[model samples]
Target: MTSRVLTCLLLSVLCALPALGARPVPAPAADGMAMLQRVDTARVQGSPSTLRTELDAQQAKAPKDPMPRVYRAFLALPSDESFAEFKALAVVYPENPWPHVGMGLVYVRWGMLKDAAAPLETARKAVPGFAPALWADGLRLQAEGKPAEAEARLREALTKLDIPRFRTDLALLLAGRPGAAAEARALLVRSVKDWPEQPEALQVLSRLAREAGDAKAGAEAGALLVALQPHDREAHRRQADAWLAAGDKAQAVKMLERYATLGGAEPAVLSTWVKLAVELDRPEDEAKALVRLAAATPKDPEPLLRLATLAEAKQDVAATEARLDQAAALAPERADIQVRRARLLLKLERYFESMAAYRAALAAPERPVPEAAEEAAQLTRKLHLPASPAKGTVEQIYDRVSLGLVALYLEHLMEKPELKGNLKVRVDLDPTGKATNVVVLYDSLQDVLITHSAHVAFMDAQYPPGSEPQVYQYVFRPPPR
Candidate 1:
């Protein structure tokens, strides 16, 4: 058996035991037993201070009774003082089985299985068919790796007193044995029915259902566990897994949402929830999970980018831009973010900004996108050179074109200082602001770079659409040194 099962058994021994029906006790001992039950109730009520106060009062009232003394010893468990208290009780009440049971339980809890065997046998001898002593001995034998003997003692204890603890302990033991799963499951089912608050039984039942591939049963047990321990993050996670296995993705998402809400920062859980929400076509859920995931991992830009995609799908341009901006800020050098931003700008008809974004993407220090160069070049060809040529007078339009040419000249000169001569260019434009042809009437510079730059600038300039094409000419001059 696993150490978890052993621990459960040991805790059960310390907490409470079934009534000893095979033997009778004196009136004072019965009164002490009644007071012990009250103490057990207080313990279950989850008030340690109150349980301690009640236990002390009971011990004072019946100093000679082994029942109250057993509880007192149990309260001080896993301590040398508790062992001393149980030993003194065994000496004072040699015929009572409880003191001997408490001593053996302490030794078993301490992993001193050899030391536990003697007192457990002594208790069994003091009162034949005593279920508590038998149960403790079964645990000791189980710890000592004697499964057959341990199973026999546990079964005997169940026959003497068929309580929830006995059922759970036997179920735990049988669960590890091949071909005994059905019986173990039945025992745990009955145990949980008798005591719905039994976490150990529910945990075992959930595991058994999962192993048996009974997704519905596993989900039920997991739900019970979550309800019993709402703050347990792992319980919520397991519940989600069970629900997902049962083909109830909506319920699984709810469980995962609860887990995240409860401050569960596990990336795997958040990532799974995000994926499920997307599969379910739940944009809202996806966004919520992404928001939490972004918060959980401050350095990760993936969640923010996903959120941006989701917002864009919903046509929420503002939110899309906001999320993308946040993601870009987080990873300024990400080529993917720059590409996405460029696409968004292109969609918005902000051609210049889009080109700038594409250039940024292409200029990334690492993983520079070579394809963005083609995209930016294509964008420039598609743009209108002068946005509203019809709205400006011819002189105004010529001046704007001349200023644009000067800016390009200065920009290129910074890279090529030898290109100092000016060129006379003739440009023919269609009424729709498209440059159809360009000829360098005279090129004092006679340079390929200047010719290409002038041709590109005139072709990309926007113009007004008219019934016929328009032709214009300008003489370019280099600035004097």
Candidate 2:
């Protein structure tokens, strides 16, 4: 038999096992049917050898009954020998509906839709309203491109027996038909309600709910599916997506975290987690996701860059620099990384190093930052100031003081242009290159605001470290427009 036939036969045997006992047999064979039900129930709890022994005993007890023989043939199914056994039983039990149903089911499983029709019709004729025959005929008709007839047969079979398989099969058929979604959803809801362990029904319901834009329902179904199959990574991912769609980001993060724990290391998965974490203001979770994303995609510098930003926000300067270094190594031609490093160094008051970083960014082969050239020039001028303790003579320390005043005036004092003045200020430098105090003695403009502002601005200045305190006097004037 073809692989398709084998697969169909396997599914038919497995899915139909429980329904076999529930299917109505003739009144005269009620006792034999009860025994068949017992055998079917025992099949789950007993070993194969034990089941065979019980089947043999049942056959001896009801020698005239063909159900036990049918089950025996079923045990060796999808084989030529099993087909021969079923065919022999059909000939011996010509009046019985079961043997004909068995032959029809075999033909259906084998993909012989045309051959399956005659035997299923024969079984239906022998036992009017036989659900099994109707169900098999429905399948055959569906395969033969006769959906209307197939639907009719399945509906009739459901009338006889409202089992999970019948409901799900009919739901699946209706699910494919346009304008039948409501009915299909209703059937699937009832099927899953009646049989909570039905994974197939839940799977279809989840998909239909998602397609219908009912994210809440989809998430609920996905949650149940995850509970049923906790190890299924796709189920967790689907649940995560559904929860995210439903606007429950916390729950979505939980599901995605579970997926990751289950070895779901996809960059997309990690990226989504990172995004939600950021939106939810969960910095720790964001860091964790970025870490995993960085590890998962070694060549991608984005995660590292993001990590650097996060570290900088948390005031973790060392960690921020480390992440920036790693990202720069990965993307040497990216000017943005160099800009970030320069900014961080500036924050740390490392002007020379910051200037070098800005220059590097300006010279980057790719994505060079044109504005960084101006930033580098500003830092270079500050570094070369004659009064700068690192590069200037002690006499030119007053020039450094003048530079500080000019910068402070442009940044804050310029807001009050009327306050422009020439002031004499005394600045005392400590051994640590820090300005310990500033005393403004005279203001030519005679403005108290300018003198007080000059004192505050000089106090913030830095100079070369001296062995002892050294006081310097400088005269500052507003820059000429």
Candidate 3:
């Protein structure tokens, strides 16, 4: 018999067990049998209210039969009413295995495995090898996390009655155990091949294949699942992930775009799509995903940070600065942001400002990289800033001996007959009068080497203590041509 016909027969076994008494009720008439099939179809389709209405009609048509009442008990909620209905049927048809089967399934539906055991065992003893009893017991064991026992019962039920759900059940039970993925995949593959419309089998097969490192199998199974449930967003995502695992990035991007178009574009998914776009050399696509992600999670700094990195790669300094500023504003305490801002400022040729930014980055509560501290020290030396200051007066700080020291350092870097021009140097001093920074404020001859030498000499020199930063100007002219 076909699986559908067999499924109907199994459901009927749960409803139509033999009644007890000297004169038992006759079997359902052809019309009543058709009505029972309609109720079974409704139950399978998950239309519980329709199933209830059909069962009522079936009961009215065959008033003496207990099957309609038993089926009604399956759909009853609050379960108390269902339990009462089952008990009433058992009382009237004391020898029927179905009433007990109904009670067992009711407890199973309510997730009360312990309470379901006695009734299920009684039903098994009432009619040996009853398919519904075995099926319910198998599921109850599986729910209780006894997969070995559940597997045994489910396999036994399938041997007697090859139900497709039973195969899926056994496959699921096996899949949960380590080292059983291949076995589970084999079962599901056979089941799907036989019942091509089994969505659950296809889904399980996809997961098992993905976990087994068989990307081709996973992608094929996932493709079938998405086709079967076209509007299921998660199905599309799973297929996308499967394609990615298979190293089919183009297909992965296509599937994920479809997911986004269907409104399944969460921040995490969009983030993945962004990475894929970058790998595929598609900057515009990457930016699109980043924009979506930033909008989706307005408070998250990560997406903005990634956008800043992309901007820097394209040499778009202003865009980089703008994005980094936004990210820093969102998470001011983030040391990474501070470090990026410092680096960006240096690239813009704002040396002094960049130095301050670098210093702030180094001192943030979350420690910047040690390399950043090293880079800041390098900037300090290059800018002719004092590494440290010693307290004292102008003479105490820069005596004739100090002036000679500065002149000596400059003579070493000058031309044989030094260029004849007035090189005016301005040194910014700290509160202690030590020159913290020195710049070639005025270079009359515009001699690059002279200006550099003078700045170096000033960086090496020190001045008297002062309450605030003091500027010192010095005029130098070549002695001879």
Candidate 4:
């Protein structure tokens, strides 16, 4: 009574298994359940191919057991084959909810949001308190621009499960909210407390602590993370970032060097290292790191541009231009690369080529920040060239952004209650965009000033529709002059 789909899948597996060059062992007796568990354990430990071989060997002995196929699906991480195996297993083992949930995870991993929805929703209906599908649905909703709704779903997920890892994810998503970053900290704090050996939570705690400017806390968290997960890529990176945040470049570099040595450091990580190295004024280190990263990732123009930047910092125009050529060929569509090339062309007094490059960058589709757009506009006007503007603008309604905000200043904050006066803000509206100074700025009119976070809101501020220089002034006055 096997369904046509199930029969077809088995036949496909039969055909493929033969090409795999392994003689099938007859399916084992029910007592062979231990062997199936062995396959599951191996897959969990990150050896899928070994599990596949085990499955091939076992299939000859126990062709009736669908567990090996389910095990295979588990190890196929981030692929559609997992769903195929799950579906086949579902037909053979109709009562199992695990396969359905496994199918949902495959859709989540592959970013097939719409397809993932039905299967996950079905699984949620079947298993009312399943955290995995709930977490997947939460993330999917977040990506679809429904953060508030995502948060509700994530909270529902929280009610269903008391898992540290899923809670950490939910907390991180919450941190994007106005005051909910504290919840993220609390979640990590609780996670580390309960699962002290959990590397990810410890690493996240390190990042959170450093961001909060608590060096002592960050150091403790990082040390714990490194101890628990010595060779983990994220652990090393977080340690490096923690050191940098704590103002210890030497230590940061040591950790970063180790990170770069680790396999699979993403390109963005390398880019951040290059930027920091450049700012630290270590040309040699920057160049070395650039070369290492350039060799590590695929031939992306970003690394080449970083190399050119490092060379430029060393005042080697010839070498810089050579690096620029490498970048230009690979990233013909990257506006930032084109912008960098245009600036280099300008330095070379190659006005025409520089203008062309700048124009090409200007025409590109990436949304430049208000400040960058403003800067680009200025450069174009200065050079008497026509300039194109970015297509979008966001409107903000705060009186002004400021620093040293007390309860009085809280009113000027995003969605905060009442403010007593006109808040003057020190904002630099340049071509990259408006950056409100977060440093302490005293205001005489009110007993206290607005919080530095207000300035952060402003510095991260994007203006609406105009290339005008952003100017902010917060004046705190008494009720009457």
- Model 3 poorest ten-residue lDDT run: 26-35
Cα misplacement distance, residue 9 of candidate 3 (Å)? 26
List all candidate RMSDs to the true structure: 14.0, 13.3, 12.4, 27.4
TM-score leader: 1
What TM-score, computed on C-alpha atoms, does each candidate reach? 0.64, 0.56, 0.48, 0.41
Q: Using TM-score, rank the candidates from best to worst.
A: 1, 2, 3, 4
For each of the candidates, give the backbone clash count.
7, 0, 1, 29
**lDDT, candidate 2, at 340:** 88
Clash pairs detected, candidate 3: 393-464
Candidate 3 similarity to native, TM-score: 0.48
- Show where candidate 3 strays beyond 4 Å: 1-69, 75-78, 109-111, 141-148, 192-203, 223-238, 258-268, 275-291, 297-481
- RMSD (CA, Å), candidate 2 to true, equals 13.3
Among residues 3 or more apart in sequence or in different chains, the pairs in candidate 2 whose N, CA or C atoms overlap within 3 Å are none
Write one digit per residue (lDDT tens) for candidate 4, span 343-419: 78767755445656666677766633234455455544443321222123422324322222333344444343343
Residue-level lDDT tens digits of model 1 in 1-481: 3555455445534443334444334223334334444444444445557766776797578544456556766766766767766776666566787778878988998998889989989988987777788888999999999999999999998887777777888999999899999999999988777666666678889999889989888788878778777787788988999999999999999999999988898998999999999999999999999999999989889999999998898899989888888887888888778888888987886555576678778777755676777777676545423333323444455566665556656666777776666577776767665667766677776555445545655555565655234445545455678
- Answer with 1 or 3, whichever has the higher TM-score: 1
lDDT of 3 at 461: 55
Return whichever of 2 and 3 wins on TM-score.
Answer: 2
